[model samples]
Target chain A: MKLLELRGLAASVDEKQILNGIDLTVNAGEVHAIMGPNGSGKSTLSNILGGRDGYTVTEGEIELMGAPVNGMSVEERALTGLFLGFQHPIEIPGVTNMEFLKVAIDSHRISLGEEEMNTRDFMVQVRDISKRLELSTEFLKRFVNVGFSGGEKKRNEILQLMLLQPRLAFLDETDSGLDVDALQVVARGINEFRSDENGVVLVTHYQRLLNYVNVDFVHIMINGTIVKSGDAQLAHEVETHGYTGLGEA
Target chain B: MAVPQPANTLQGDLLKRVLAHEVQETPWLDRSASKSLLNCNGFPFPWKGRWQYSDFRALVEDALSLEGAHNALQSSHDVDVRRFDQPETEAQTMEFGSSDGVGDFPLIDINGVLFRSGTKLSSIAKTGSVKVNDANGSVDRHLMSIEQDAGMTVEETFKTGNRVVLCHVRDNAKLEYELTMPHGEGIGYHCLVVWLAKGSTFELHLASKGAQVRRNDVIVNVLGENATATLSGGWFVDGSDHLDSQVYMNHRVGGSHSEQSFHGVVDDRARSVFSGFIHIDRNASATEAHLTNRNIALSTQARAHAQPELEIYTDDVICSHGATTGHLDDDSLFLLRSRGIGEESARAMLTKGFLRQVVHSEGGTSLLNL
Candidate 1:
């Protein structure tokens, strides 16, 4: 099943074109890696797809599960199986991780016409996921990402990923600023989340994260458009040759 | 403990409750020393000092309309005064006057000017707790001194009108004061003045819910050495409500430490103002003071103003201050929304989190729900 399709997608911020004429498709059970240098607009694609403010889509079509996402709000898109793991997770003091997680899950339940998860069952599920992510149970009681180390913040994002469980997930720089250990944990989460029923759009600055997570396709983006598309080995070529003049039409 | 002074007496005719007119002697209006406050035809410049963000004239106008004397202060005082250790004479009798370090604020004069009744209590207790509840919009004046080596706790819950609390923590004494203003349709104001003597300690907890307009002025003066003071406040306002929380901590001697922290949330078209001031005298050398105010504005139309002022004359003192006023963090909002939470519910949860932080700052349970 096709999870996401972006055909000739173009977007801009402050009236300046950012994602210009981009095209991509992700089917269920496939993981696509998007790599680029600074200002290549890798994050812009994720932001536009995620329905963030300040970005105007100049031209394109975004569909999740064969439905147009043109007029959907951010939360609506999320409920429709669109999730973007932020590169810079926000620090919200006083909002405990447990509360945030429960509320997020309950929101989905309410939207899907399902019963809200009880506290005991929710705690059990969260504790299991947090344990898998090497997060202490006490972490659930603390404010979301407040005073958390860089590694901890990354892992917490993964924890959210596993719990929220979007059908098509866009991991935007999820591996940036993470140590070797934290990167492996994030890779583990991606591997655990990947299935024949879900898809992944991994955007990163380096090929370091691609080493751990297997990729079905690799696309090198530049000037707000993908200039190179190839198999998994293409990542090695870019790592070795650099992106100096890779955009050869 | 022999409680001698009747509850209705004040030094002389000064604290008496009387109407101000040509018919009778208005002994209560003492306009000699605090004339700057009493004789003000209108508030100073509306945009001056603490009144910068909030217009004093508007607050005064609306608060006056809500003023009424119904059910004069539903109060219940539980004074557990142990044996007065010192001879009754040694318990210093301090008179209420302008010389006692209270700044001449116009709001204080407005409170003293219009009030159906004025209740005065001069208590010297070792360990006592007093709880006063005021649903009626009435003004109250209370003077209490924690005798040397004594301790006292005061909890007040009120709505509308004004409340003036004059407290003195004598040498080696402690004072814990807490004030809660529930959500109300009227206005509310509280003016708290605390004086700490040598080796004394003082703590103030102020929690206010939404109101039409509210102002709290808690000033603590550390005159003695080896004293410690802590003040924490929380407030939440929504709709067209407005709140102004002002705090001032002064260190006169050395070897004293003081801290002031305030957290609040403003939603809808509400406006919240916070002003924290810390001053260290020239002789207050080893004095340490810190002030921090954190606020979250939930709506684009909502406004928050935070002013942190510090004046340190001594070289050995350590003073720090920080104030922030911003809308609900976008990053947090995005994270929540991207997880399938609706925009409204996510904002509400984030707002609740912010309020809970403010309430639990003083280690109190979170009784507020959004």
Candidate 2:
């Protein structure tokens, strides 16, 4: 069954249309890479999928696990097993990373009718995740992304994805500012999030990321709509010749 | 949470003024307090001036009444001493309004510091005199002694009324005390005085809620060549309770250092006021002083007012003061909520963090038990 299904999903902000008619679907356990030029509505699609504010869904429907998610809020969508790693995550001052994580974990735990983790157990779990992400313990004490570098924030977002274990993850430009080493680490983290019950949609402007991580399907987005779709080799083809070769596909 | 008791409702200034007199037997102290009462005539209703933003007058007029001031005096002197944080068994203590000797701490006097509390209304008559003004351009001062290691806690419930007064802490002595006004009655005061010796220190921790509390604390540190003093407090008021703390600190001698910090969180219709002033003398060279006042307004009706002033007479002295009053940051709140924390829980977390800054600085971590 499709983990997320979007049909004719048109969106607008302040009377300006960002996304036209768009149709997409991802079944469980599939990795999809979306490549598009800047302002080609790549981030807009991710935000709309995440139910972020300031966007009016003028038309179409988005279903997550068979439930319509078009009217849900960003937080509501998060609780519904949908996670989006932003291109530029917001920096929150005075909020420690650990405190933020505990609240998120406990929230999901309560909804699942499970016992909430105490401070000691929560710290242990956070440490384990941090170790896996190569995140230092001191980073957990600082404010969330307050003074973090671009790569550090991207890694932190993946760290959150690993902890939340969302059913569907939307990574928006996660490799924009990463070096080769950081890109490999981020891909490794994503590989960890890949499970039979979950799916990932990596939104990027270039094909450099596909070098480190494998992509099952490569969809080229133009004018807010997926204009072409092909297997993994398509990414390599698009990398060399750009979208010029897929003309009128 | 609700207040445990009902508020008192007495009318006019005369009735409340007379009630203050009858509660204390110290005729001298009675006379000293009455002079300040004259200023109450033109006292700006908490809503009448720049201070008019919060409806403090309505709170005083509606939520306050003539409570048993004498009962408050009785409780102050009789609180169980063993329950105190730092108990002193041997110290020269003077008996005044504090019946239980709440500030009785050991080694304070031997350290060349004197602390006194629970002095009777009569004992203040023999001490020296102090002249100070209330908010309404009225000057009121009193005479009191330096009772070493004598202290008390004022645990009064104000149903509809409050008690206002002036205090004097003499030089070269130390005093540490706690003022806990939880619920029921409201306590209002015009001015408080602290006359520090050349090398004395004073520490005070105040926590109260469920009433309208307004107190003015004035400290005049007579720091002899190498003297120091520290002042710190935390005010956590919730429900319909209102608490105000006004402080004035003066560094009169050179080579003296002073630090003051107070934090408040006002919830519901509760209001907290923090007005502070720091003065550095001309000859007080190499003097270091810092003052900070922070408040969090939790509800729309919840109010906070802060005015931090710094007066430096010597160019070499380092003195700084900052004041901030606002609700918790929405971004911080959103960050917590995104993690699944409810709005209420997020507010509590921030409030606790705000208060923890002061508690940690006060050198007494065990007091919070958190």
Candidate 3:
């Protein structure tokens, strides 16, 4: 079954149309990349899928596991296993990273009618994931993303992605500000979490991240809609020729 | 022109009620000093510059009625009074006006009168001081623990009426004092005075939860050289409750450091007032003092008033103060909500984080449970 299906998904920000009839689908075990020029509504697509506020769905339908998700709140979409990694992660001073992760995980668990993870097991799981992501234990003690470097913030997003283990993930420009080493770590985290039962969507402007994570399909989005769909070579073509060179693709 | 004394009757009524209590003459509670203070600085009114945002006339009147006064004072085991030296059952008569321009405050005057003639005093067993000497000679890194007066319970209910706490930390000693006030109704006037000796460190944490009306006045005097004092308070006012906190830090000698951090949350129609003053006297050069007060109003009707003031007399001292009042950060709320946490839970978490700074700074998380 398809993990996510967007049928004529149309959305706008502040009464301005951004996503004009965007149709996409991601099946289990598949990875999809959406490359777009600036203001192509890439982030808007991810935010609308994740049910962020202020993004009005003027017309369209969003489905998760073949079930419609209309009018679902941000947290409701998240509890249903949809995660949107922010392009610019917010800094919440005073909310420690550990506390945030615990709450998020518990919220998902409670929504699924499962017992909350005990502290011992939760700490063990976090330790394993932090070690894999090269995040220091001390980082978990600090405020969430407060004073973190650009690369650190992106890695923190991937860290949440790995822990939440959503069925479908929308990484909105997660590779924007990461260094080579941090990018490799983030890609490794994504690869480790990717499985036959889950789907991944990578939204980016460049093909650098594609070098680390292979994709089954690459969609070119221009002016609020996907203009072209191709295999991995399309991403390399855009990187080599730039978006301006691919006219009316 | 004569000052309009609209609260004269209220003051007269309060004085009458205070005099009705059994009188005990002690040097610390000098009736003459109290009367003089009252004469010079009458009851606090909104017209007063410092009290412009806070009016205590109504609270004082409610307290004077004596309705439910006994029930309010009954559940008082939660009030912990910790002292390093032998508990002084016989109150030591200390000069009130020793600090320049401090003893003239209206709250201090009322506290003086209430302490002298009204209310009985109790003493708990003494506890030894916790001392930490820095082998590395670093003034910034010091060891301290919240010390409980030996016989008092860890939790204490706030009793209405007047209460006074006097603490003196010996030279080179480090002490952490924590006071937790549980949920209750009625009015309370509490005064806490602390004296730090040379090279000593004093950390104070006060947390008040759901008090109908509470007024806390804390005065810390850094008398010795190289002494440091930190005062942190968190107040959660809800319903129709009101909380007013006044903190005064006096840097008497050079090389002393002091800081005050206060965080308050006002919900429903509740109101919170915070006034912090740091006075750096002359010859107190090299003194570093800072005060910050931040408050969050949760409801449309909730109100918070903060005044962080600094009076520096010396040129070679560093002193600054800041006060801010606003609702919760929308970005923070969205961040939490995006992580699968519901809106209400996310709000509660943010609010807890707001107050966690004060509690965690002084290692007083136990107060959160209360």
Candidate 4:
């Protein structure tokens, strides 16, 4: 069954149309890569899917698990298993990473009517995930993303994704600012989070991240709409040839 | 001979009468105190007093509509002092006003210390001492002044009308003070007098959550040698509230330290003003002082003004002050939004982050109440 679907979706920002018409669908456990140059409306599409503000969808429809997510808040969508790993993670001063994570966890659990996780269980889980993501325990004690190196912030997002275990994850240039080692760790974190019950859409300008996370399909987006769709090999082709010839096909 | 207009004469008489009345109220007020009050009254309307450029006085006076008295106090009068020790309703003494539907907690004992939260009323002063807790706590025996002096902690909260009165800190003592006032109905007056004794240490924290019209006047006196004072404040002014804070710190002796940092975010039609002065007296050598005020205007109509002034009379002193007023950083906003956080959520997060500094600085469960 299709776990996520976008049909005839159109979106715009500041009264300027960005996503003219978009149509796509993804089943459970599928990894899809969206490749386009800057201003191809790639970021706009990802943002609209996550219900970002300033973008109006003048036409079309979007459904997650057969439920329309357009009216849901960012937190509501997050609780419903949608995750957006930002290209530039926010630096929240004074609030420690551990504190934010616990709040997010408790928020979701409370919504689900589950018992709040005690400190012992929370710390044990945080330690386990930190080891998998190669994050220092000291990092959790510091304020969220404050004064962190570029790679560290990106890895922190993945760590959150792994812990939250969202249903559909949107990776927005998660590969940017990451070294090969960091990229592998990020990919490993994503792989660990991925299961038959979840899916991912990787939005990137480069095909390097695709090398680590095998893509079930690749979609080319341009001028606010999907121009072409193909297998994982298409990512390598675009990486070499760029946007040329692909438009002709 | 041309006669002065009755209106002008009435205004002058009113001002003189106010000064005269206040002087009578505080018989202990020294020569300097009397001169400061007169100077504040003589300060020309909309001219160069501490509130010269701020619309605080007009806004508050119009909102509260003072009739018989410029100051009023509301006391339950039953005076249940025993309730100061427990967290239960049986122990609750006062309820100032509603707070986000989270009813205010009454006076409680923390580690044998007695503290009651600030009420939402103006022109009132209530006093109690930690001296009562001396048996169970190690508090300073000499720190019993109604106003902050050296060697004590003062926690007071209130909602007010148009004026805040005197606060005094004594010489050569260590002091810590906290003020938390969230927005509520009506206008207020906050007249404060802080006196610091020779060789004393002091720290103050002030936070404003949501108040429609708030005007505060503060005077701090730092006397004697080796004295230290630090003041920090934060305000998240939203809705249509207007807030004003004016502080005057006097360095009367040598070898003193005074530091102040005030920050705020004003949204909607809200406005905020912060003016701080650091005065170093003659012969007050080796005096070190710093004052900083920063603000973020969140809306097109939202406005803020920050002024940090330094008056130095000694060549051996090190004093610096700065003020900045602007909106949130656009680049930072873009950075957060790029991460898939909606623009609105991103803005809210950053605003909350800015205020979190004040909350986290306290470094305790006390912030949970905030």
Candidate 5:
């Protein structure tokens, strides 16, 4: 069974079409890069897969691990190993990051009939992952995302990506608003999360992220659907020549 | 659940009955309250921002139900307590619900007030606990004073009652007072009025939850230069509960600082009303003050009203006020739910975070069953 698949997916928000008959398939161990111009429905597609509200799926079928993703709640999808890293992680004051991630991980384990993690072992694991992501363990004690810089927010999202270890990770513009150094850190975290048992669909705007995290397929999205699909060379071409003629072709 | 009390109209005679039946010759019970009490004129109709969303007529009548006063807060041996008339306090002058445009709340007469004798509070800093052991009463009044250059920490608790604590922090003194209002089905009206003299510091942390009717008021007057006051509170209400929290900060002197922040969570058919008013007197130059009140409604039927007001009459003053009344941020909730947390648990976590923004465990936990 494929990890994630979108068939004839069309979506709209506020009575306006955003995704017009888009089709994509993500198999295990495969990384797909979905690059799009502004208002090209790349975010709409990611949001639709993540079950975010305010988006009306006019016509589409989302399948995760061969099971129809329709009618599944947001948390249900997450428990089923579907994680979408938001571009902008919100600030939740008064909730420690450690507590938030622990609860999330505990929920995932309970759904899989696994016991809760040992607190001591969990802390060790958190420290190790945070160190690898170049984040201070002190951040785990602070409130989630409060007073966090743009780069810090992006790195925190990557931290979640490594902790949850879901089957399919759909990241939405996670590299935007990040410096070169912070971008490399984020890319490294994403690269570490890649494995033969999982799939990743990176929704991005620039090829800089692709330089660090190689993708098997690069799909250039214009209007509402993928206008062009090729190997990593497609992203480099779009960067040099732009989508001026690519969309028309 | 409908309030067990009938939808009785607030009669004019109610004020006269309170004064005639229970009148103490104290500054807190001064006749100044009579005008505001009668001005209510039978609680204005819905709209015009007067007693619209939540009504206190039930709590008023409930507080005045019994004849004579339930016992004043009995102080244990560790704490010193006295009557309002015991200390020579400045008489009369304190007014309520005037010139703030906050809401036309009725002013109930002060029944019985307890004042801690100021003779013991000395220049040295000390820690003291004031327990309202039997404070469950129709009305309870407490007056305290921290002497010049003195410092003390006070913690008070009450089950179900109306309490008014008027404190005087002399010049160069510091006081930290934490108030805990427990969960009860009865009614309560609690008010804490403080006067901070020159260079004095005052902090009041309060946690209130679950009552048929619970009213809280924190009024502070920065009367001296360099005086500072920080007031914070958290309230949780659900299942037909009603919480009314009002804050008033008067910066009358220059070089003073004050911040007022409160957060509350409303669920089910419960209701919460929060109004914060910061007044910077013309002479209050170089004063800095901020007021914030945040409320979150968990249910569609739940209601939250936040009104933060500022009246700055002086320049070179950093003064601002903000109030927001709405549901928890959808993005925050989605962030949690997208991480595999169940919807119900994620919402509860967000709701707790919303309230904990201002209220901390160091103060106390009084969220009914939170």
Candidate 6:
């Protein structure tokens, strides 16, 4: 089944056009890498898809699980199994990481008419996932993303992805600012969560992350629209020839 | 000195009633201080530098009207658990000076006069100290609990009946004081005066919920060198409740330190006023003092007034004060919502966490539950 489909998606910030005529689709079990240059509206597309405010969709249609999601609120979209991993995770002081995760998971469960996770079981699940992500149990006691290193913030995002287990995830430049070791750890987390029941849209500039997390399709975005779509080899071609080389294609 | 009548009729009537109460005999009473306090018209209003952001006229009137009624001075005794006094020694009978005219509020003066008039007082003494060394080479000192015999636990509700508390932490002693105010009707006032001797340490934890009018005035005098004091509290206000608190940390000698952290959450048409003043005397060289007041307004009609002031005369001292009032962070809200948390739940969690940060501990947990 098609997990997410965006047709002729055009959005603008403050009356300035950003994403122009963006059309993309992701089927279940597919991993699509979106490579773009600076100001190419890559982040804009991710934000609009997540239903963030301040971005006006001039002309577009966004569907999740074959249902229209253009009018849904951010939380509503999230409750429907759509997640957006921010490039720069915000630091929320005073809210413990564990408390935030519990609320997020419980909210989703309650919306789906499922019972809330008990403390013992919730802690067990969190411990298992945290260990896999190389996170200390002490990290759960601290405020969400507060005072965390750049690499820690990226790992925290992947941690949420694993716990929330959204059917469709948009990772916008999640590999930025991560060292090779941290990148490998984050990639392993992503690989562990990927399956036939869900899909991922990897929005990044480098092919390094693609190497770790297999990508079925590569789309080169320039000037707010996808200019080229090809197999995984296209990512290496862009890496070798640069974005300007693709502009002439 | 003859008592002066306040020009304001309502205030004058209230002062007369207060002065008419029989003066209780006590060896610690300072007649001169009481006489001088009676001569003042009334507590200062917002025009006064110290009371710039708080007004007590309405609260005073409401309290005075209940003075002689049946429900007047309803002694719930719940809040009385927080009252801790030291055995009176010759050293504790020092002259009671008038308000320093800068940091002291009129409510404190009223409390002083009433205290001299023999209000109910309690005493709790420390037998021995428990000191534990930390990994950082610092020592954790534990003093006697206020409720030593009753098991160290706080009561859920603080029925704010009019009362006066006199606390003394002697040399080389340490003490922790906790107080929680519950929701109630009518106006309530509580006054606490603490004296710290040389080498003494004092920590205070205060928490209050919504009420018609609840006011707490705390005065701490670091009388000797090497004395330290830490004050932290949280207040939650909803509906039309009004919560006003004032803290005065007086560093009278050199080498003294003091710190204060207070947080408040105002909802609906509720309002809160927090005024913290740290006064470093001219001779209090090498003294260090810091104060921070943080507040969040949950509704458009809710209001919060925070004034953190520092008065330092010694050039060798370090003192700083800061106050901030605003709604919850938008980025924080977005972050929570993006994680699938509902908007209302997200707001509630953030507000609770904000207050919890100020009063985070076993003692604080009880207060939050209230």
Maximum-lDDT candidate: 1
| Count of backbone clashes, every candidate in sequence | 0, 40, 5, 40, 2, 1
Q: What range of 10 consecutive residues in model 6 chain B has the weakest lDDT sum?
A: B133-142
lDDT assessment of candidate 5: 0.76
Worst 10 residues of 1 chain B by lDDT: B15-24
Instruction: Please give the CA lDDT of all the candidate structures.
Output: 0.77, 0.61, 0.73, 0.65, 0.76, 0.74
Residue B261 error, candidate 2, Å: 6.1
State residue A2's C-alpha deviation in candidate 6, in Å: 1.6
Candidate 5 lDDT by residue in tens digits, B7-45: 333344455554455333343534434444445444344
Q: Candidate 4: where is the Cα deviation over 4 Å? A: A113-115, B1-8, B18-49, B52-202, B208-215, B218-229, B236-243, B249-259, B265-272, B277-352, B360-368
Residue-level lDDT of model 3, residues A89-174, one tens digit each, is 99887689999999999999999899998999999999999999998888899989988999889888988998999999899999
Write down the C-alpha DockQ for each prediction. 0.78, 0.23, 0.65, 0.14, 0.73, 0.76
Candidates, ranked, DockQ: 1, 6, 5, 3, 2, 4
My TM-score estimates for the predictions, one after another, are: 0.84, 0.66, 0.82, 0.68, 0.87, 0.85
Which segments of candidate 5 are over 4 A away from where they belong? B1-12, B22-60, B66-108, B112-124, B361-363, B366-370
**lDDT by residue (tens digit), candidate 4, B1-370:** 9876664455455444433433232232122332333334342343345546555335422422332222122232211222212224521222211111111101001100111212221111233222111111111001124322324444545454333322344454455556656565765545445566766666777777555567665667786688778888788776788777878888988888888877778888888888898889998999889888878888999888787888888799888899898877664555444333455755776676666665533422143233
lDDT for position B225 in model 4: 80
Candidate 6 stretches with Cα past 4 Å from truth are A245-249, B1-10, B23-32, B40-42, B45-55, B62-104, B112-157, B361-363
Candidate 4 residue lDDT tens string, A1-249: 576799999999999999988999988889999998889898888778766668788999988877888677756676676778888887777557886677667666766899877978999999899998899989999888998889899989987887777778888899999999999999998888877888999999999998889889999988888899999999988988898776556
Docking category of candidate 3: medium
- lDDT by residue for model 6 over B1-370, one digit each (tens)? 9786544665566667656644344444443454456555454543356544445665445443432211111222322321112325443333332333323345545544444212122224443222111111110111122322221222223444444445556676666666667676766666667778888787878778866877777889898888888888898899999887889898999898898999999999998989887888898999989999999999999999988878888799888899999999887887789889988989988888888777855545675662
Recovered native contacts, candidate 2 = 0.20
| lDDT ranking, high to low | 1, 5, 6, 3, 4, 2
RMSD of each: 7.6, 9.9, 7.4, 11.1, 5.2, 7.2
Highest-scoring model, TM-score: 5
